[model samples]
Each structure stands twice: as C-alpha cells, then as structure tokens.
Target: MDMQMARIGLFFDGQAELQRWSHQENIFERFIIEVLEHARVPYQMIDDISKFNTVDLLIVGLASENHLIKEALLEYAASGGIVISYGGLELLSQELGCKILPPLEAGYLVLPAEFGQEDPLRYLKANPWQYIDSESVKQTGELSGDDQKSAALLQIPVGKGYVDRWAINIPETIVGLQQGTSPVTEDGIPAPDGTANLDEGILKADDGFELDWEKDRKTTETGMPYFFTPYADLWREVLLGHLTRRALDKGLTLPVLEYWPAGVQHMAMISFDSDMNINEAAEATLQVLKQEDVQTTWCIIAPGFSKEIYEKAKVDGHELALHYNALEAEDGVWSEEAFLEQLEWLKGAADETNFTSNKNHYTRFEGWGELFQWCEKNGIQADQTRGPSKKGNVGFLFGTCQPYFPISLADEQNRFYDVMEIGFLTQDMNHPSLADTTIIQPFLEKAKRVDGVAHFLFHQHHIYHLPKVKEALIEVVRKARAAGFTFWTSKQINDWERARRTLTVSANGRLEVLGAAELPDVKVWIPLADADAEERGLTYKYGLPGKTQVLQVQLNKVEL
Candidate 1:
C-alpha cells in the first residue's frame, strides 16, 4: 500500500443493473463518477472483485441482490475496507443488522447543521427512500416528510471497517434535483409564489423553477432576504465530506483539486445582455469593465451595436457570445433552424468565427433537452439560460452556481451534453427596494461556500439606464476583487474547466497532466495521513503542524 495515497474504486454491477433497470445509462455509475470528477478526487472504476484489494474505499452503486457481489462486499468489509452503498442494500440488511422498511415517496434529507445549514435544519431533496431502521448502527441523518421521518444515513460497523449507506437512490434524486424531475411541457409549472406568470407560453427557465419559494429561501442580512440554499451542490458536499471523514479516519490520503486557479478561494463572472443594442449603453458598460480591469461575457442580440463597438470589445478581451432571441416581439422563432441562423448572425456581427458561450434572450427554454441538443450540435461550449428572470425567483433557482454539463434524460444512453450550463445568480440587480450590497454580498458568499462561480448578469441598457444597476456592478467587481477573485470571461472559464478535467493523479502520487495541458495557476492539494512521515516522497507545500499537508505541484511541470 502507498502510505502517501489512498485509491478509491467505484464498483459497478452490469448484470445486476440490467436485471433491475432497463435504462441503458447506469445513472448510479454516472453519478458516482460525476461526484468524484467534480471534487477532483482521483478514483478508478472497477467491476471485478479480484481488484478489490487495490482500493482503500469502494463505492458500490446499486447494491442489488446478487450473492457473489454481496459476498465480495462482505469479504472486503471484514478485511477493513470502507464502503459506501448508494441503494438496494436489502441484500446486506440482515448481515449489517438493519431493517429495511417499505419505500416512501419523495421527501427531504435532514442533515446536521455542521454541513453548512444556516438554520438548525437544512433539507436536501431526496427521491423515494427505503427507510432503514437499526438501533446499533449510527444514524447520521434522516429523511423528513410532513408526516414521516425515517433513518436515511447510516454508518454500520461491519467487522473492522464500516459501510456508510444512503438509504435512497442518490443518483436519480441528484439528477432529478439538478435537471428537474419533470420535463418542460406546454403546460408550464405555474409559480404559486407569483414569480413568473407564464401566460403566453412556457418557454423560459423560470417556468421550470422547482424550489418552493417560502420553504427553500433563506433570510440574509440584506435586501429581500432571499438567498436560496443551493440544495444540489450542498448535497454533493455532504457526500464528499462523508467520504473524506471516513478516509481520514482510516489514515488514508486524498488529493482535492481546488476549483479556482492560483489558489483563489472562489470565482466571479460578470455577464451583460446587449438587449436594446444601444451603442452608448454598450460603450458605458465596456468602460465600467475596463475601469474595473475586468473582462466580461457580452451576450449579443441581433442588430447588435456597430461593428466597431464589437471590434473594440473583441480587442479588449471580452467574450463575444450570442444571446438567442425566441420571443415574438423580437420577431424570434423558437426552432432549431432559427437558433442556428441567429448564431451565425452573431458570429458575423462580432466578426468572430468561434463563440464559446451563449444565453437565450428572456431565457426562452422550451423543452427538457432540445436546447442542449442544439448547443451540442452547434459547438456551443457553454449556456447560461437556466436562471432567474423574475426578482422573486432569484438566487439559485436552478440549485447551483457551478457550471455543469446537462444530462440528457431523453437519450437512451443518458449521455451528458457537451455544453456547460453556468446558471446566473440574478439579473439586473436594479430592484427599487433592494440595495445592491444586499444581493451582492449573499450571492457571492453563497457561491464561495459552495466553491462555485458567482455569476452576475446585468443588461447593457440597465447598466446605463438604472443608477442602482451600475452601482451594483461596480460594488460586485470591487468586492469580488477584494475577496481575491479574478473576473474571467465565459470562454476563459470554459477553457480552464476543460483543461483541468484532463489532469489525473495516480495511486503512486504521480500527477499526470495529459494532452500537454499547461495550467500553471492550478493548485493540487493532497491531504496526508502523517505530515512528518519520512516515507512521503512529495514535498509538503502548505499546512500547519498536525494538519492536512498540501502538495502544490505546477501542472505545466507535469504536462506530457
């Protein structure tokens, strides 16, 4: 065993998966991979039980009733290997001394307050849970509904090791929470909160706003008191933190790649929608960005400002991205062909052949996956349409500020869309009653807490027309700068994320930067079991005594 590192293995049972679910994409498998990938935790996918000895922790996806698989897991646990079970734990219920109750419908996972809950209670969205009851097993969390509360998270002692279990289908629930449980049909989800009245048609992201405004929205110190808890991202952290605790308890080492480059705590991106195509407004917005020494993403509409203005923007290193209009007022059509034509128009208007990102005008999203499909087909690297259009719907209505590839629920393969969706926190920031700092502070703070990008959207017209909007923009830029965040263009952010995904850390502590990728600013921090271990070959770059040691390796040096 490498004393300096602990390898993680995710166990997939193809045979059992085939028997239980007809879906081609093993969502459990994909979910585990996505979680690990996002956390920058190095892991290997292993199906064979013969290689169980290679991993310090084995995550079993959909632990169906297969005798051989159950036996292997039992053997591994007996030998002191940590295991995390996603669902289908009935096979080991008796052996682990737990009673599996009848399943309950969708509810919330009431986690401990230590896991970033502002109040005494924080609930993560959950799919149906087959409640587990055990007096002996340690219960870490519970599934909560109006009339029922059941044991949801359990740490069962199995010989020398432990089986950490989530008594639900975590993957399905996560997918549902992030992508939405239902499709966006013509009959839109009516907002009872009176956020968006989809009278004409349900075409925008706000139509699919899933969170219950009253229950989910948390009160902040500032304006409106509607800083929404990012439930999906928080749930992801809970899983990661659980795994990390177990690994550390077992005296194992795990490396985490920080989200931002150059060791910054978090990131912020300021985006502008060129709605009216007003030349003066555009110029004023550009000047604000320049004065702040920031490069932003300009989502250009058709008949955008003059070619000279775009040229100046391009020259100033701002990202020129398309803002697709699908409203009748703009003579827009909501079709694939229409989307393509507008994209080409923007490319010509900006005089740029390669535009990396886009956001739909009015956030006109019609279907569950069609827009993403169009983005994939058109080589659009990122989309920012999944966010709030109404004031009441602000702050993580999509459940995240992080950029993630949308999963294709329609596809048989359940493929991930190549295009990244970086949902904005809020738009305009010009509400009459609200102060700019009120929204600015909490949104940025929330993004920082989740290690995500604080994306602020301000229309070019609003920046010039609304006094408060300009004030908000300046405040956001200044505060984000003071907090050590580098404002990046959407293209830059997309490029950085894509580049970081290529990096891999091996079990032997050899960090591999594949594809000759050179990311000098990126930081890789490895938590060591013993900071003073003489056998540790890697040089300790950062940490206090008796704390986790970080190895700061330059990616450029390791690039192949």
Candidate 2:
C-alpha cells in the first residue's frame, strides 16, 4: 500500500510558432504551470526524451509531432504511464486506441452538465469552447448535441494507463479569444447575426471569439443566445481530472487541502471601501471588528476627511489601503501628473509616507498594464481592482479565485505586471438586482469549493445606512468562520502569494522554499491514501523570519 508521487512531464518541441506565441502572449503552458503549482503537483518541462523514464504522466502539445517523441510516448503509455495529448501529436492516435477524425468545423463545443456532474469539469459546463473539431472514439464520457453526437473529449484506456485527447486547440483558442479574434462560420465568414447553429441545445458566436452575452445567459434559454462557461475553470478542471486519476491509480491521494496557510481549506479578505460618511462608518466598522476580534482592510478615498479614522484603524491593527478615486480616468488611461497628485494627497491625508495596497475608485482603470506600472512605481505592492464588475456582474471576471499577477495582452512582449492583483470576487454593489444579501453565500461556496481566495469588498456607508447590508456582513463572518476560513487583509494575502511563488515540492517528498520574505506560520498537509502506507512526516509547519527553508518527508515507495 505504499504511495508514489505523480511526476508530470510536459513535452515541448521548441516549434518556431510556439516560441513566437510564447514571446507574444499567454499560452497554454503558462496556465498549466499555474494550475500545477496551485495543486502542489511536481512537474518539469521536458524537451528531451531522456527524461521520460522519470515521468509518471506525459503531456504533449500540438507542436510535438516528432517521430522519436511519439515512439517514446507510446512506450511510456504501454508501460502504465498516463499520456494527455493536446491538438497535434496525431501520430499516436491509432496507437492510443482513438481515431483523429477530420477537423470539426463548428463554431463552438458545448459540454453538457450530464457528462461532467461528478467530474471536476462540472465547473466549466457554463462555458463553451469556440472553434472545435470532432474526434471519433469510444466515448467514455457523456456527449450531448443536436445533430449526430460527436466526441469532443475522448478517454481511451491503453495497457495499464490511459490517454486523454482533446479535439480543440486549447492554446490557440485562448490566444484568439484574448486577442479579440472573432469566431467565424465554416464558410470563413462571421455567422449571420453573430451566431451559428451546432445542434440542439447548442448556440455559438458567429465570430470565432466568445461573445460576452453568450456567457451571461444559459445555453438552454429561449433562442439559446449565450453559452455560459468559465474559460479558466475549464482548463483547471481538465488538469484536476488527469492529476486526480493518476494519483488514485498510483495508490496516492490528491492534495485537496493545501491552497491556504496552515492547510486551511479557504481564505477570506474583507475590505470596507469608505466612499461616504467616513468618520461614522469607520467607527461602526471598527466596533464590529473589535466585537468579532477580526482584522480587515479599510480602503478610504484620497483627499477625504478620514485621517483620524484611518489612524484609529491602523492603531487597531487594521490595514489602511489607498482607495484611488480623485484621479479616475477613462479607458484606464491616466495622466502622470494627476495620478501623482492623488497619491501625494492620500499620503499626506493619511499621514503615512508609504502604502502597500490599493483599489481604484469604482474599480475603474484605463488599462491593467498602465495601472500596474503606476502602482509599482508608487510602491504599491498589491491592487484588488480587477474583478468581474466591469460587466456589472458578481462572479470571477478573470476566471480565477486566487491572487495572481496580471499579464498585459496588449504588450507585444506579454510582460507581467510587477504588482499583485487580488481580484475582488464579490462586492456589495455587484448585484444591484438582489434586494437582500443572499448572493454572498453562493460566492463563498464557489471560493471554498475551489480552495480559492474570497475577497469581499463592502462599502462602509452601506453598513451604516442599510440594515440588510449590515446583516449580510454579519452573516459573511459567521459562515466563513464556520467553514474554517482564515480572514486576512490585502497585504497579508499579497505576502503569502509572494512567498508561494518561490515554494516548490518534488515527487521525492522534498519541500523547498527559496523566497526571502517573512511569511506567517503555515502547515503543509499530505493525505494518506493507502492502508500499507503509514503517514510519515506528512505534515510540516514553519514560522516567520526564515529566508529559506527545506523539509524532507519520508514517503513509502510504491510499485506501479
């Protein structure tokens, strides 16, 4: 019953197109890397076949069409290693026991709920894939469509392992969507009235790109104008399924509880945006926090008369973050002089020389890259302005529940923003249609289910003036505590993410920390799945001030 860690290997052929694309924009590999890190899965980018011997799972991209690589992958699968192929790598279709049919020239691919209810892919049923072809194989999963049912995803069991083949070019599809490339019909023209018919219960955008409206509504609605799906969620689901299956097959447990510090299942950050009545609102919020013994962030508008309240909150161990309002600009475009003036005013008003976090007023910014540059230059370590509210909705705008650095799609070099973006998943004003606070529970549930950060933004004025608002805030704290969520400020969340960036775990049970930041006490949890595998050094806890830390845990060896 010994357990073996899963070693994931990604094969890259160094193709010129891939290299160019990597240089220009975010690619599938980047997403894969992020998902793997979040899941604490050890992986390596493999360009040479020599490394195949150490890999338990092999991931091949479309660019990997070399004959030698194909032979290596087939052998690996034959020897009981999982192999997941994306786009290309067509040479092994027959060997993998699946047939790669002609390219499916459809506008979009729909993933019905019936097929993925128990799978991790259930989170992606709301979103549809744009521009997908068809694959012919024994459908191991459910397939739903109007015309002849086709396999969008195929799982074929080969010797002792399996092969997962995706019909869509996922990386290219992501790039096209990011670049605003429109989805077109099979005739190479935009679909009439910006939509095309796939089958029953399927509607796709005429343009090759996903339309915002499609995601705002349900696919089964009248006319089925929209195909609601979360793009990032879909990718994560694909990875999670493969990783989980491999772990189970290897007599190991998937690390499902390692997202937050101290092995906490989830995290919550509460911030009160002081838009009006700063003095009274601040006092009320402070009293509430003191009563609950919780520390939260207070974002006050610059040049406002809230200096005394800000100082009081700081004295109470609450975070005083800048709420940039005076320098609001259109299209995220800002004037340097005006921006600097706002920053200076906030510093003087709060009587603080430096600030670590910010959230723009109304969450408005000219451009993410420009805002990030300004924040970095101004010594702002974190920004929580990026959320799903841009379209005036309450959901993950970036399709991510965790904090991450924003990448500029417009920048030809595809540079990473120097600042951390703690995306706001929910705010008080997000759902104007709701009369009460029922929306909070659903958002919290989603965050906890994914072991993601639940960053909530509430207005101080609302708590003071609106009864329902105060009730909602109370309910949030109660439910979050009941669910074992660690409440953190923006600064704390930023610091944790920064530390995790340099943390690494190897398949051999080596935990390495290369970051220099001072981190809070955290516990790493590794579940014991096998009866014969006794938990040996499965959990480790570390406290502050360590520049670098490494721990070695003894894991039982398992035979494949």
Candidate 3:
C-alpha cells in the first residue's frame, strides 16, 4: 500500500454525538484529521467495524457503547490488524490481556513512552491525559501518567497485531484548546496577575490581550492547537513511526525526514520589521548583513520611508516585503478593501510592483483564516505574522515551526488559501529577561533538535536604539551560522517549502515530483539514510514545468 494513500478508518459514535461532544464544530475530529492529512495519510470515518479489513490501520474513538463495535474490534485485532483506541479502553481491556483498574483522582499527563530510542511517541511529552488504571500487559510501553508509577497509555501485543490503548481524552484537550481555554487550568482561572515564567522571563499577557492565558501558561495546560505548537514535528514523528513500522512489518521501505531540505537539521530565517529610523536603521542593518554575508527579509512600512533606501536594500540582496500597519486600520480590524488600499499605496511608494512576503504590524488581525485568505487573494505568497508580539514569550501560535498552509477553523476543509506561513521562533525585543545574550541559543537549538525552522525577527529601530539588542542580533547570526543553519530570506524559504509539498516518496525508494511544473529551479535534498537514489547517481537538481519526474532506488539496502 502507498503510505501517502494509506487507508485508515476513524470510528466515531455518531454524527450527533460527535457534534454535541465537540460543541457542534467538529473541532476534535478536525484536529485528528489535520494531523493525518499533514502526514499524507488518507483516512475516512467509518460507522461499521466490518470495513476494518479494508484499511491498513483503525483509529476508533472510545465513546462508542455498541457491543457489536467492540466485538468487531477484537476480531480485527485477533486477525492481525493494528488498532489504536482512544477514550474507551475498558471495552477492550480483557481482549487486550489487561484488567481495568480504578481511575486516578488527579487524572494523568502525557509523557514519553518508555520504549527506549525506538519508541515513536518518545519525543512528545507533558500533554494532558484522562486517568485510568490497567494491569500491565506483555511487551507493553508506558506512554503517559501523572507520576512515574501510573500508566495512561499501553501498547498490548495480541496475536500477530497490537492495540495502542490511549486512556486519556485527546479530543477533550483539543476541544478545550479550540475554545481558548486550558484543559489543565484549575477551573479555567489563570494565575494571579496573568503572568508566568516562560523560558527565562515573566510573560505578561494579563493586560486584556486575547489568548493571554495561552502565552502565560508555560506547559501543556496551554491546550491543543497551541499546545502542539512546539511539538508539531514530534507529532509527525509519532505518526510517521506508526506508519513506517506497519510498512516495515509488511517488508516495505519508507522515506524518513523528507520534510526538511537535505536533512541539515535546523534552519533559521532572519527578518527585520522596519518600524522607525528607516534611513539610519536600514543602513545599519544592511551593514550588519553585509558584514556577516547573510541575506534577510526586510518588512517595510511604506508611507514615509524613502524609496532610495528600499531600492538599496533590494540591490544588496535583501527581500523588501510589506508590513501592514495595524494602527492605521479602523479599530484594528483589517478588511480586504482596506488591506489592498494600503498594500497598493505601499508598493507604489516603494516603487515595487510585486511583493511575495508580508508580516502584519503588532501581529494584529481579525481572524487568522481571513488574513491568510486576503494574502492569497492579493498575491502575497508567504506570511510570518501568526505569533505573539510581546517580548520574553516564545511559543508556537500555530503549533509548528515548519511552514504550512493555514487551515480555516470556520471552514475545516477549505483549501483555497495557498499562502505559506513561516512561524516566528523569537524576536530581539523579547530577549531582555534572560540572564545574558546566550539565552537565545536554546531556542535555536530546540528548533534544530526537531529539524524545524528557527525564524527570528528584529526591529530595525531596536537595532539602532539599543546596543545590547544589536549585540544580541549579531550573536544570534553567528551562533546560527556555527550551528550549520542555512539562512534564507522569507521568500526563499517560502519558495522551497512550496516545492517540497509537491514531492512524493515510496517505501521501495522511488522518488517522484508532482505539481511543481510552474515553480522555479529547485535543489531537492534526500537525506543520506533515504539517499539510495543519489547513491545510484539519480538527478537531484530539478528544473520545473513538468508534471512528474521519477527516480528509482534499492530500498532493501538502505539503512535507517
């Protein structure tokens, strides 16, 4: 079976129950579906377990009280099929060779499963899980618990197959996050003063900012969507590990770590928001870029800045993109008409006809989906504004450091917004709370450890006004270079990500390119572990305008 189209079934209780449970929005199902879709794993909801034989894997919700469904699942597992159960493990505990124990009073928290280095869920930790008791099963891996003694997740081997029992309520966590409430918060009340230590400094979000608790909460209590923010790569790893294991069990090969370019580990993109002191700041920032031989994206507010400075930055190999001024908008709400008016005015003032990148001032927007749609409709190809604006606080607003097309929360399946979103890791203005300039190094290291993009933003005014800010920016660039990060402007990163989304890999080491005919020439990198085609002298440089390109390799000899 093609992993890209791997057939998986999601068994739910019913449409009405799902709607009522998810608050009539399908948020829970959508969250799971989004994860599956991102992994290129095709899935569909099934009302009957009789169709289990047709799928490679079965993910069933625990809320189903039907005995027929329970019996069907047992039969499927016994017949050598993989089953992952969420919520309702009591119905299958006996079949799984375990006894259900009394639930914990304080519930459970998600932690790394003790499966050593081979565990797929090893990297993901600290999410909330529902409490449950279970007798230890043979060959089981403990994945979650409140303390080291409890078990929230258990992998039970039955016959030729296995069942992953997720006792925690993942859907509830997702639903609570979508509602802008933390699942683990005590009665939904935030800490006194709404300030909490994140990384090294106290992040203050209590001053009536929307999503304030989200920024203040340092741990998984921030809830899903955002809770998954720093761990999107880990989520992908868990999903890919499951799929890869199933494929290997069937004597097949699968590509690994193909999302990043050439598997260089982590990447960094430097950008400067042109706030004030346009001429002096731009000149100073340009000097630093030239000295470091680094190219970056410059977001310019075009009302009063000199066209000569913009042209000079463009000539110096820096990207000049639009910075939508939120203060200019009426009541900080951006309509398509008002947005376009400012975009055109800015473009004309800067003497640029086309712009492919943008970052909104103050990171303000009416709706994330709306902003993405407007950018797509207006010809902006990429954006980097979907993060918190305050300093001393750094976390994923979208739960990913990888570039992805923003999904519409209102219309879950609408895919028309083709613009790419490159997440912001940190900004220079927010670094003062740390002990020294070196605190930013860990942020970059975390991104690298997960093979993510560590895009950093600095205001030109800050660079000119604060000596320590300039020193910090310089240190960041130097450290990123030493860490083997290939620095790219926002436009370059966006273009590369667009090309990557079109790539397809097979278990047998066949590489194919699709839907990239209109894109520019791009250098595709397959990691050495998956570099069987390159070992056989396959072409790595691809010039597009072709719908498909195929390369074959020997998968059996490829090492993990």
Predicted structure 2: clash tally: 19
> Whole-model Cα lDDT per candidate?
0.72, 0.56, 0.56
Candidate 2 C-alpha lDDT tens digits along 345-454: 78888888988888877654443256677888889999887553322234543455666664445243444567877767556632333223454565677677556777
Model 3 per-residue lDDT tens digits across residues 59-80: 8753355678778887777787
Candidate 2 displacement at residue 30 in angstroms? 1.9
Off by over 4 Å in 1: 1-3, 16-29, 105-110, 113-135, 146-149, 187-195, 198-200, 219-227, 431-437, 506-515, 528-560
lDDT of 1: 0.72
Candidate 3, superposed: residue stretches over 4 Å from native: 1-23, 31-51, 60-75, 85-150, 156-160, 168-229, 246-252, 263-265, 302-304, 328-332, 365-368, 395-399, 410-417, 429-436, 509-560
Tell me the tens digit of each residue's lDDT in model 1 across 65-184.
778878889889889998887655668877776665657655566566544444322333433233244465777666666344556677877788888777666665566656776667
On the 0 to 100 scale, the lDDT of residue 50 in model 2 is 73
Give lDDT for model 2: 0.56
lDDT of 1 at 461: 90
Root mean square deviation (Cα) for candidate 1:
4.3
Worst 10 residues of 3 by lDDT: 540-549
Better TM-score candidate (1, 2)? 1
Candidate 1: residue 448 Cα off by (Å): 1.3
Better of 1 and 3 by TM-score: 1
Q: Would you estimate the TM-scores of all the predictions? A: 0.87, 0.71, 0.70
What is residue 501's positional error in candidate 2, in angstroms? 4.0
